[model samples]
Target: MGFVPSQDADKIADTVEPLAERLSEVLGVDIQAQVLVDYTGLVEG
Candidate 1:
């Protein structure tokens, strides 16, 4: 997930983590919520 540069990192985590948890349950696998630093970071990931 990508957030605006000014958005708080914790806010991003709050929004994404829950979804990740739900997905992990449904998929029966670990799902990490990775917040991208930038487009380059996403590409590298």
Candidate 2:
């Protein structure tokens, strides 16, 4: 999957990164994910 950058820098790596890692480990796949900033940014992407 692919996406364009959002408006705000609300990545929240501390939370999102670990969750993605755990999910990937449990599911046995390289899960690519992203933390969106807001509704508009999410919709546009």
Candidate 3:
């Protein structure tokens, strides 16, 4: 995923972590996951 500012990365992580945890608990397994936010501009010439 991509975001305009770097701060958005933290925000996204905060939102997704709990859900990931809940999913892990429900499935009774350790689910390895990661949320990566690229703070880069996409330009075309």
Candidate 4:
């Protein structure tokens, strides 16, 4: 798996890297996941 930053800053990049690392180790495989910042309304558009 690989890691990438969508934009420039600590907030976005800082979020997913550790999660991917830990997930990779815990799953005992090359694990990859995307972190989506869901600021949109959950109930409706």
Q: Candidate 1: how many backbone clashes?
A: 0
Report backbone clashes per prediction: 0, 0, 0, 0
For candidate 3, write residues 1-45 as lDDT tens digits.
Answer: 222334675676677677778888999987654554343342210
Q: What ranges in model 2 sit over 4 Å off?
A: 1-11
Task: Give the per-residue lDDT digits (tens) of candidate 1, residues 1-45.
Answer: 344334776788788889999999999998888777776776777
Best of the two (2, 4) by lDDT: 2
Which 10-residue span in candidate 4 carries the lowest summed lDDT?
36-45
Evaluate residue 7 in candidate 4 and report its C-alpha lDDT on the 0 to 100 scale.
68
Indicate the residue-level lDDT of 40 in model 1.
Answer: 79
For candidate 1, report its TM-score: 0.73
Better of 1 and 4 by TM-score: 1
Worst 10 residues of 3 by lDDT: 36-45
What tens digits encode model 4's per-residue C-alpha lDDT throughout 1-45? 333445653565567668878988898988665434342422222
Kindly list the per-residue Cα lDDT of model 2 for residues 1-45, writing each as its tens digit.
123344434445444667778889999999766655556666776
What ranking of all candidate models by TM-score puts the best one first?
1, 3, 2, 4
Candidate 1 versus truth, CA RMSD in Å, comes to: 2.5
Q: lDDT of each prediction vs. the true structure?
A: 0.75, 0.61, 0.57, 0.56
Which stretches in model 3 have alpha-carbon errors above 4 Å?
1-7, 38-45
Residue-level error in angstroms, candidate 2, position 23: 0.5
